[model samples]
Each structure stands twice: as structure tokens, then as C-alpha cells.
Target chain A: METKELQEIASLLRFEAVRMVYEGGDGHPGPALSSADIVTALYFDILKIDPANPDWADRDRFILSKGHACPIWYAALNERGYFQPKVEHFHLRQLHSEFQGHPSMKNTRGIDMTTGSLGNGIAIGAGMAIAAKATGKDYYTYVICGDGELQEGLCWEGANMAAGRGLDNLIVFIDKNGYQSYKTVDYTVGRNNPAERFMAFGWDVQEIDGHNFDEIKAAVAAAKQNKGKPSCIVCNCVKGKGVSYMENNNNWHKGVPTKEQFALAARELRGISL
Target chain B: MRAFSGSREAFAAALLDMAEYDERVMVISADSLKAMRAVPFGEQYPNRYVECGIAEQCAVDVAAGMASCGLIPFVGTYCGFLTMRACEQLRTFIGYTHLNAKFVGFNAGLLGGEREGVTHQFYEDIGIVATMPGIQIFTPADPAQCYHAIRMAAEVEGPVYVRAGSGREVSVYGNDAPFATSGITVWKRYGTDALLLSNGFVLDRVLAAAELLSQREIHVTVADINILYGDDASEILREMAAANLVVTVEDHNINGGLGSYISKLACENRPVRVHRIALTSYGESGPANELADAYGFSPEAIAQAVAAARTQQ
Candidate 1:
């Protein structure tokens, strides 16, 4: 759980995520790589979970609302001992693979809810939090959603409910990578700040450097400390975090990387700063 | 003929009965507690009631989430909003996962919310909900069937969509009548010349149509298709094959409703000629009975359609 070890895990997750996209022939590598650090921190440093007992009643729930970046989640889960790292782990998006293009609760391990459609995770997580509150369980629910997913109206519907009901046990992280499907989120939508939007919806909002482990840990800790309101941590991130050529490139959002690009991404994630 | 009684009251009574025994039974509404007659349930089990306040999509996804954690959440809302407004959430969150969520679509079909115009009245929900795989669609006739269908929904696991009709209910079966888990329930078997299939409040019209046909010396088999989806179909198919003609009557649109299902079943299994007496177009604002009559779902209209089919045969 040291900073260096967490950094190492994040790098490895990035490498695995890139490699999975490369092997699978089709995936959102940009989003996956962008969320590598946040996912790594949650699995390794933050979330209270048991890989052997994914359905433990007292375990904290994690929902990846931005589900296209599931390769990052799969990588983190594999490294956290949820499942053994196998050659097939790289067979993401292939027919019948446990790692689907999007997170499937039925197919994936350690996934509490199936979320492919945008804006659903917030409500589902709120439901979990409400269940915990109603049942006298104290387990927290953590949801990681993409900034682009904010365009979906259903997200606010859930967000409004969560805040209205005072779901303090819920914590959400918006991966503000700026890019959506084809272009920047601001270019596609307006330059709306997620911090202001969630705050206006009665959430406890905070801005953080998404790739910075210290800020990520501190923000989550701060969110946990706050009471009587659901928390939203806006993590500003690069489209592709660890790779040089794929960084901020929208075309790399889905296309499988060439052999040279894959090798270059792998080398960069293996301790190269650039 | 008995007076028309709304099924929403029966649904509320059944929901309250279930909530009394099962602690997991909770109701989530889009601010439709009064419309759904779930006030008593809310008052008795205040902790179990959730008011989502007009956000149907959030209500459904919230129910899906609650179901994930071992709670049976029933969503109560108007059929128009519940089926279309929150359809994506239903399809992805509840239907895809087959969550233990029950959706009671109050005010279903063209006869539902007659004065509310096309905005509130939905005649296309059955078809839309039928497209979602693994979600059982239940269309109940009379208050007794409504009670039984809701009770079944609470006891059954996975996703269940109960198409609870609006006000203006008719008694098709007695309170003590047994509920069928699959296939159609035969209420009046006059003859095998035609298989008359109908459900929900429209069954009353179909029954009256049968009586009118009997006056014309045309005896027909009258069966209420209480269970819409997940039927074993062997018994229903046998009943269909026995008849030379099959006439399906409903208060819903012809496409993707009971008529379409029966027609497909007959064409595939029995090869019988099928005639559908249903709303082929959208509903407009009017009195419920007047709308029903104009939409070609009245007793006289159904009888005429059946007589015409008989002549063709």
C-alpha cells in the first residue's frame, strides 16, 4: 500500500489494459488507460473487499459506471487476486470471455452491477447505499463514472435522488478525461464543470488530480469523512495516461493498436516517465 | 352485467398483503402513490416506500439496485411513462440482469387514462415490454386476477412486469377463481368453432360478444389470457388447433399485444386463421367507454368482427 507500490500497480494495470486492447482487436484503450490510476488506487489502497468472497454482505461496493473502460477494472481485479492472471485475461471482448467490452455483473468477478449504458451506476450505487442504510449495514458504495457520461439525463436523475435522500455512504469519482466518443466533452457538450453540476445537485464536490495517487487517496478519505451528503470527486485526467502516442488521441479510443504502438505503450508503462 | 370496478385497488390490497408477510416487499413510485392506491402500503410501511417524484427511469434503476441487494422492489407508475420513459433503464438495469424487480404498470393500454389524451394513455407497452428477454409480462382481467397476478409477482423471482389496467374494471371471474401460472384460462366453452381470446378489462367485451354470438347461434370458446408471456403453450396450442378460427380481443394496439402473440402461435402451431380486434392506432382524449367503442373493442364491435370471421370461414 506504499506510494511506490501503488504507483507500480497503476503502471502494471495500464500495461495490462493496453495489452488487452491490443490482443482483443477492439476496445476503448484510451478510456481504460486513462482510468488505470483511479482503479488501481481503489482496488489496492481504498476499497474494503475480499477477492475470494465478492458477495460478502459487509464488503464495500464498487460500480464502474463508465463501463467501456472495463479492461482497467479487469486488470486491477486480476492483480488483486480476484482471479488468477491467465493468458485468456487478455481475450477481452471475445465471445464468452469473462472480461466483456463492458462490465457485466453476471460475467465479471467483483462487479456488483452490470453497467454499460451511461448514467445508471449512480442510481444503482445509491440503491446499494440505501439498502445498507435500511438493513443496518455500514458498508460504503463507491461509483466511478466518466465525465462524458454526464450527458446522460438519467445520471442526474439518480444523483438528485441520492442527494435528496442524504446518501452519505455513497462516493462517486468522475474521470474527467475531456474526451467523449469522437471529440472533447466540452466541444460535444458545453464546457460545464462537473464540480459545479454535482454541487448544484446537493452533492459534496471536490476537484482532484486523477493521476496523482496522493490527491486521489486524500480526496477519497475526505469524501469518507464528510457526512449527510453524497460526495463527488472530479479527477482531471488525460485521455490515455501512460502511453505517449495514444495520449489525448480520440481515434485510440476504440481501435486496436498496431504492433509497434502496442510495444511502445508497453515499454512506456514499464517505468519510462514519458 | 356487473358494474365496472378498478383493478388498481385490488393491486394495492395485494401489495399490502405481501408487504405484511415479506419484509423485502417495498414500493417505489414516481409520485403516483395515490393514483396506484398504494397510500395504505406507504402509511403502514413508511420505511419500505420510496417516492422518486416523476423520475420513472430513476425509479426503475433504483428498484433494480435494491433488488440486487436481496430486496424485492416493486415500481408503481403509469404505463406510458414506466414502459417508454424508463424503458432503457428497464432493458439494461433490470431486464438485462433479470433483477428481482416488479413493475406494476398502472393505467395500461388505450382505455387507460382516457381523458389524459395520448400523453398519459399507452396502448403500446405490451409490445415494448415483450421485446425485453426474460421479463415476464402479466395482463390480468378483473380485480381477483389483478390480486393474484400481483401476489404472484411478489413471490416469483427475477423481473416481472404487471400490466395493471386503469379504472373501469369488470368482473370476468369470481374472487375464488384459481389463477393459471401458464396458458389461457377458459371461462366459457360454448363450441370449438372459434377460440375467443381476451384479457384485462377488455375480456368483459369479449364475454358479451360471446353471448351476442350465441344469440346468432354461433357458439364460441371464451378464454381469458391472464398470463401473457412464458406460457408452456401446449394447452393453449391444443385449444387453438381445436378451433377453425382464432379471434383475439384486447384494449391494446394490435401489434405486439395478445392478438399478435396468439396469431403467431396459431400460424406456427395450428395454422388457424386469426383475427385481431384491438386498437390499431393511437388513443385520443374521450370517455373510456366511448374510446373503447370507437377503437373497435366494444362488445358489439367484437361480436361483429367475430361474425364476419365466421362468415369468411
Candidate 2:
């Protein structure tokens, strides 16, 4: 797909995520909006998955390790035709909604693994990669982890094991949005260089603008081409990318927006239907 | 249908058979292959076995990962380390998500160690694991039950915690004993003045107590509760209600173990007098038999408890 088309999809995903949060009365829109471009790039272009057959054995696997941002993931899945992309599909965090607060493999059609707790996705992705190797399958496993989620000790365990085993089939993207739950990532957890850490763990590391389609595509291509090591793409991103009022605002991490704020954000994210 | 001399040996043999049956069956252990006696399985299918060096938390998460990919991964380690150290990881990834991960907790209770002390002994494992919803917990009494339990757990969907022993256990039941997917196994029954519920290697002691009680004219029924927390507690409850007193004996802490579980059942359904005989304190380092005797789980101790319960009634 062209850069323009990817960008269009990214905007639509961001819009749908906001609409889900807005309609559902509450959700973590910050991370959801932040992950829009990366999710859009993977679902629309990079990932080798069939919407009709979510359980295709030979298909590439993707795990959302930072699972609270599932609104964007649900949006991507919906637009990809895993389910109908209707306005009613925006009932994200409802009691019986298949689109739960977190990604559940049993509940969602396109989800490969159930992930809600931070730091689990990377290891599970590594497990799938290990399984692929064991079964002699040639499918790549992609995992998107949040910068805040890296604070968990288990992520390092998976990373260490992935590198030790030389899992070239595994590729990870860390959404390096500076804002975390309470404060900025650096202020909350110090300026921990994920790229340097990945490099030290014997992973091929790349730094890129997360919102940029070209960078994401290039980084993914580079990760695929690289062998004998897992790749980590540290995507420097704004917490709320498109919304003017919500950008870099930690308070928007999770909340139901006011009617005025929702209208303003909808106008900003033009061409997105509610 | 073959049985080994010990539960751990039987467990290892069962794992080998399971691996042979299903290519998806994999084993991940925390660098205790020799201790678990899983060296044969590891050596034969090198790719299927993962020796996750002494990291219980990492091993469990790794197993959870393996389970996610349509593979039946059994994680084995010492009971204390596997339950205490990796508890959160187990609860979150395996328990909460309802993953098909099998946990083989070796050497539960005072049977685990001599040199390692309380760190290796886990009388609190059953209590900790029992709280998790939809988790299948089984404490196999002997080698036959252990072999059958492993095969059954592999066949069952969702998380299964099989508590195996390190002690040289006398056979509670022959190979003919029915190993149902869930529920209690009545080994021997007499006049049901008191129902004796026991599990693990400790069932031998409970049976011995029953024999000693009979000599004293205190007839008690002995049953091995292999399935700890299954759907049908109805059978066990009915037996408990029939008896004048219910006595639960386990090689676990009295707080949240089988004793506590039975006591709760008695309070709710039977309203019968319940006596819980289990370890009251952290265990000390000694030989396994000596530890059992010291901790009031010996045949003499159990018989004394039965006599005390008869007096109370």
C-alpha cells in the first residue's frame, strides 16, 4: 500500500479508537491513539494474516503486549474485515462485548493470544516463535509492547531467552510514547534506552518516528531481512497523536471525554464517521 | 497403564508416553532434571524439553507462551519455588487467561527436602493454588494414580496443577483403582462414625490410622481425595454428611489445605463436627519419614487424633 493510504487508515483507526472510548463511556484512549499508526501499518500492509481465517497455522502472528490499547487493535481488526466495521462495533468495554478491555484470544476473532498484564506479550510472542521453529514453520511473530510495559521484569526474561535462542523469526515494536500512567516515561521510570537495552540483549534495534508510515515500513523490512537475532523497533510517539488537546496529556490515559471535547476531537479527526 | 515405584518416576514415564502420543507435548523445567527424574524424557526428545535454568517465574511464563501456541507444555519444579516464586506469573498468564498449561509440582509438603529446609518444603501450595478459579488441582496418592493423573491432565483443557511426591510411597490402590477425571476415591469403608479424607503419600498413614483405630474399636472410613477442588464435591460432601465426624488429613498447612476445604464443606452442607490434622508450623529439615512423624502426620499421631475425636463425640 502507498504511504497516503496507510496514513488514511491510521487516521481512521485513531478516529475509531476515540469513538470506541467516547461511546463506551470510558477507556485508555491515550495508548490506543498512540498505537494507531503502528497497528494500521501492520494490519493493512506488513502482516500476512487472513481476516477470514484468523487461526491459519502458517499465518504470521501478532501480539499486543501493551493490551490496554486494544481499542486501536479492535479498530484495525474491524477495518480488516475480521468483523463488520459498523458504528455499533464501537461498544468496546461493554459487559458482554467481544471487544473487551483487553485482548482475549478466546473472545476476539483476530487475537492470537490473550494479553492484559504488561510484559506478557513479548514472552508469549517468543513462545509462538519457538513453536514456529519447533514445528519447522516459516512464519514471523510480531509483538507490539508499550514503553511503560517494558518496566516489567518478565519482558527482560523473554528478551534474554529470545536472544539466547537466536529467534530471528521474532520482531518487536516498542511504542515509545513518553507519557506513562502517572507521568512521562523518563520521569516515572528514568531515561531507560530501550534500543540500547535491546542491543545489549543481542537484538537488532532501530529507532523511528512511530507516526511515520515510511519509517515503520522500512524498520519492519529491516527486521525481516535481519537474521540470527530478534529485532526491536523503538517507535518514538506522541501519546495522543491527532487530538490537539489530548497530545502528551497524561490525564487522557483513560477517561470518557466530555461532549464538547468529543466534538472538537471528531472535527480534528475529519473523514471519520461516528 | 504401567506403574513405576515412585510418583516422580511414574510422572516422568507418563510424560514420555504423552510425548509419544502427541507431538505438541513439551516439558519445561527449572534446571532440576535430575531431581524431577525427567532426564530420560529430556534426553530422548531434546527439542521438546526446555531446561530453564533455576528461574521458576521465567519457566512458568515460558510454559504459558508455549501453551498459547497450541502446545501442551508441562512445567515442573520444586513445589515451593514453582508456587511461591512464580505465583503471580502463574495466576496472571495461566490462571486468569485459562490457558492449557500443566504444572507438575514435585515434592509438596515435608517430603521435599533434608538439606534445603523450609524453602524447599511447601505445605502452603494447596492453599495458594486452590484460590485460583477454574484451575484443576490433583494430589495423586501413589505411582499408579500419578501415572493416570498425568495422562488425564494432558487430556483435560485449561490449567492443571498435579502435586507429585518425592517420598517412597506404599501403593494406596492397585492399578485396578479407578482414576476418574475428578472426585474422591473411597479406598476402604467401615462403620462411618468418622470419615477419614486424606491425599498424597500421607494416605498410607491415614490407612494405617484406620487399622489402628479399628483395633481400639473406633471404626473409621478412609478415602483418598485425589481431586482437591473439582466441580463435584457432592460425593465427598455426601460421605462427610453421613459420618458423625469428618476428619481431613493432609501433608499441607491446615490453614488453606484439604482440611480447611473439608471444614468449609462441613460447615455449609453437613453441619458435622470436622477435625483437621495437618502441619501447624513451618517444617524443619530432616528425613522425609522423620519429618512426617515429627509434624503429627504419622500413623500413631493420626490414630491419637482419631481417638481424641471419638472422645469429643
Give the number of the best model, judged by TM-score. 1
Interface DockQ of candidate 1: 0.77
Instruction: Give the alpha carbon lDDT tens digit for every residue of A1-274 in model 1.
Output: 8889999989988998888888888899899888888898999999999999998988999999999999899888888888755444568889988888899898887889998888889988988888888778888899999999999998999899999889999999999999999889989887859999999999999999999999999999999899999999999999888888889998888878888888788778895433
Report the number of the highest-lDDT candidate: 1
Per-residue CA lDDT of model 2 for B83-155, tens digit only, reads: 8998887887888878899998988888765446888888888888999987899888888888888888998
Model 1 stretches with alpha carbons more than 4 Å out: A84-88, A271-274, B1-5
Instruction: Find the candidate with the highest DockQ and give its number.
Output: 1
Predict model 1's lDDT versus the native. Answer: 0.86
lDDT, model 2 = 0.85
TM-score of each: 0.97, 0.95
